[model samples]
Target: MKKSVFILLLFVAGSLMAQETRLLRQPTLSGNKVAFTYGADVWVTNLENNITTRLTSTGAVESNPVFSPDGKTIAFTSNRSGTNAVYTVPVEGGTPTRLTWYPAGATVCGWTPDGEQVLFASPRETAPSGFKRLWTVSKNGGPEILLTKQWGNNGSFSPDGKKIAIDRVSRWDVEWRAYRGGQNTPLVILNLADMSEELIPNEKTTDINPVWLGEKVYFLTDRDWTMNIWSYNTATKELKQETKYKGADVKWLAGNKNQLVFEREGFLLTLDIASGKTTQLSISITGDFPWAEVQWTDVSQRASSVSLSATGKRAIMEARGEIFTVPVENGNTRNLTNTSGVADRSPIWSPKGDKVAWFSDAGGKSYSLMIGAQDGLTPPKSISIGE
Candidate 1:
């Protein structure tokens, strides 16, 4: 086991230095509890004492896990039924309930802020126009509601749930093909009450992932045709570009309207709307790709990188010969361990942002869970999987 762990950690360190980091999606943090994908499984960790629990099984490729508003349940899509369909499970692990019984496969984007429904983009009917509707489903796991009659995806709900902001695929000059990235999609905001749709700045630019931050709705746009990140204000009706750097895949972590935790250029960064300043999140060379993304095979050589817990305070990560940390805001980072043979992988922050749980091969053949402190840096206690 010790020998295997050494090899695993060594591999992750090598990968970081080996490739030009392929950016994936960021985990959505709800308070101190966040969901993470590991080898087709979604696991939740409590940061208080490093208690890790598996929230998903039948894992046949589960990703994009989002927590309900009450944090008691998780909403995500799984290919367990041979196609992508929405599934819900208890935050801790239990039987999953299928939300979308559509005969067609589907993928979800965002959830309503109230946790009452989920918003997604998928083919609504038989293939004729390839019409993908902006759809939402009740958390009670019933039939879904087709909110918009257009073919689009990447949905976001305003904080109050009165409005839905999404990317619109307006012009389709070609035949409909599902699951493939379509064309002519731009940033679109839909008023649910009135069904009035409004288009934002650029039509050709890919304006996706619209997040409602209080008075303004912020989204990632390549308005300059650079695939860079941008933001929009709903209250002032002012449009703004937040970054000069080419950051395409970005996520809003947790903060007020002005402050945001996001990822850009393969680095997790924080931006302040009031100050117009950005700060690099204190993380190691963690890759953005999560376990649920690709097949369990292609990324196997890929090791776990860095992850933020619900609190977003301290970061727990595995790399090379060290599991390290610095103060998230003020303190400097300190290396917790430097064992060469123990290849630690996948650090998840607990809901309280107090403890961290990770998988390491220090024992042998199979990877197991290791729980430790958010800052104290003691050796991790192995979590029993009952295998």
Candidate 2:
């Protein structure tokens, strides 16, 4: 009976680990499928069948996946070749084809309406200021063509492919909540034919991730001190807020004429353009993470605090949130506090060399003073440090 219960517990634990996952980001939608970046790889899920497939598994930071017009191909940015560049892979999973070779790196934004070229942002031509400009390269492979001289970090072409709704500046600190400073800029509707520009209405608020769908230009903004989805109707000359999320800001907005996909609070969600309804996707990812495997790490060079014994025979040090001691000339290095889950810091040897003192959060609360023998053979006495 005991052996059967142990085996049943293992099965229960494995089942819980295979449930829905969070932290999904950079979602792009087309038809009944959506693609996003998770665990540094691209994954696609079909809304109808509820099936998810991993597209790229190179273990190289791949992100910003944009689906093509027909939903057959996906363009994304990857640093697999030592630089962030554009790459394309099929929706069903296959070999990724390199698209750009710029040394300055390129980030995939979106594709043109015709689906013949892939659009990206790069700082290749801008040397002194290093501001990015819009560029596009043929999906079949060729030299990238400069789309415009104006700065553009993220954008999407209109349905006609004649105009683009673009964000002119990319913020240095994107996650600084409720920030209103000089870095904030409005989105621009640039006419590719005459190079004329029309700025979206703004009052020094952050507006980014422009996606053009039909007569409206949809984007994410922090105008209300919380990032939410907003739209600018060109025909009616009106601006309206679509989503009223209060906690976390919406990120990585991308879409087509049918619907829009974005990330909010680590979940992938979609908004119907016609109906204005939103739905969160439930996706579960199961795979082997080689980097997360348990292994020994050397933290000697990461020592943050150190103190020498009074006799100069040993030294106590704090490194990687743990306490350690090393002999000056004779003995091997010893880890005095091996509590990996707790943070032990500011270690110092006692003046008489019989004890070690440090601050630790071993009680799972606030830090407190910990005093123990130098050999770590006895239990450390923890003294409370009140709030």
Candidate 3:
């Protein structure tokens, strides 16, 4: 009996350890290593040895790590100096050297093909805040050069350095799957010598991350439902799907030479350019996830979309993507949507003061109208809203 109980406990512990962990974003690849952002901090991992290293350990968020062409340094964005600014540090890990000092922030997009300068996107001259333009600054820190006069962001220079494949508009919600909103637009490859343009034939789909690799432009598109790797041959004007991912979308992709690496569903995958073969790298990142620590958090400032109950004695609120109900004078505070990977939004209290309604993706591909009791006792009713 004692042995059976011990084995049962061991099985439970193994199950808990096997739970999936996510939110790994903005991955960039070099010749032998891959760098990505996890828990708002930059991390690097070797593709061959599976050795992982932490690049930054600051209170402020640091993200969007891009490797220099030589693979000696990494450029990333950090709010360590107050506002978001471009910064670079040694790939082995050390103090970062600030590159841009303008009042408006810049994000590292990619390095110049010649490796002379670091390319970035900023909105310093743009009147509006959302619109961004591509710019480049010397790695040694100097004046910024305007790469594009029009509104554009997330661009990569061609191999010849005379042209670029860029995305004109940025999406508001990148994780909202199959989004065909007004912000969606096709990518454009602009020739700098003649100021000429060529469209990539996007009818009404979201296309982004226009990477110019040799004579082909590799990008991410949700035209076939789930986001997958796609390539457009400049010479033949042919578009083809590179990967057929059915479950999770490919999060971030970066490539150099004949190899490409990307992150998908918290796992790292590498694609061989010549052979068209993809291999999932077995990388084990072991470090202190400081942000994942359990502690009391003040959700007051994070609250949004609050609606009062019928009698005004209670209120339903959405805070940090979780739906909750709090009392004014009596009753206990309850978290309605406790599932971590799911998204519950626009929570509103019912007029009758008995139920709450909200729109939730629930980590699925579609959104649903979720209705449940205000007190958290009953299972929520989910009605499909749309795809």
Candidate 4:
């Protein structure tokens, strides 16, 4: 039978070449472990031996790790003291404990079902910093209580924390895909013993991470256009669709009583609120990506656009999408649109010094111009712009 179909295509290509794919970012789940955030640090995973440890390797970028309802503590978000505050460590890794300094920067958003309070989300007394509120600070820090005066961006804490499901208004673009606009609200649930409010069912589209647990609340929805996993039922008010994921989009959901972790496409998934099954955790991260190693990167403070050389003896720059040229005092430093999968950009430098235009999309559908020829050696003429 064709040698058993070529040995079942080499056992599905050697079981997908012994698996390894990682991008991981903002995951949370607790109860067998799963904190996440790659490259910018913070990692942890066990889910029965998927083993991944590495928690917080400083240099200012840590992000939303959250977990600390007794999961031994995590609470993240750190620009390492240049803002974006709120820190805390020890989920088996030590020394972090900073906790909110406030000069406008807070986001952690989790902790406080009696873990002694951490939760965040800020706008520091909104006046035009663009609405946000729901604070709390005291894991031994000083004062910062504001819990909810409306205006939100992720909240969850109900299992007798006296209610709070929140998500009042947030979405200046949570990734945009299939966004039905108007900031897509619908997910309130408040009620701190009578501030009463129970929305959930907005029809606008991008509902977001709400969480709640026990009689159900969970969230993240694009109402069927990608970001999946949903549920509502606070006693049969029915609204289900627990993950019908059609490939990538349910990101950073987080959960506990029997799993629910999320983040998709860069892998790190979980879900199993009792076998509603959705597993993807095989994790394999092996150290040192040091901003993706290979060193040597000054990028003149992220250039953006420079040009010169109409006899100025070389310049052209353009940073963060590559396209270099440099040499105003000697040589060597070319790069010119190293096309990291085409995005080239507005480079411009040719007025009789031998080409260097830009604008490419490299035909991954439209936008061309391109022109090249200052030593990336011939072969670059393109043209074709629009559509």
Better of 2 and 3 by lDDT: 2
What TM-score would every model get versus the actual structure?
0.58, 0.77, 0.73, 0.31
- What is the C-alpha lDDT profile of model 3 across 117-153, one tens digit per residue? 9999988887645589999999999999998796787
Where does candidate 3 stray beyond 4 Å?
A: 1-21, 128-130, 294-387
lDDT of 2 by residue, 221-337 (tens): 989989999999988989999999897799779887779899998899989878989998898887766665556676656787877899887778887778888777667677787
For model 4, give the 10-residue run with minimal summed lDDT. Answer: 5-14
lDDT for 250 (candidate 2): 94
Q: What lDDT does the true structure give each of the candidates? A: 0.62, 0.87, 0.83, 0.79
Ranking by lDDT: 2, 3, 4, 1
Best by lDDT: 2
lDDT for model 3 comes to 0.83
Question: 90-122, model 4: which lDDT tens digit per residue?
Answer: 888988888788788888889878899888898
Decreasing TM-score order of the candidates: 2, 3, 1, 4
Weakest lDDT window of 10 consecutive positions for candidate 2: 4-13
**Model 4, CA-based lDDT:** 0.79
User: Which residues of candidate 1, in runs, are more than 4 Å off?
Assistant: 1-24, 38-40, 45-54, 57-59, 170-182, 246-259, 265-387
* Number of the candidate with higher lDDT, 3 or 4: 3
* Clash count (model 4, backbone only): 0
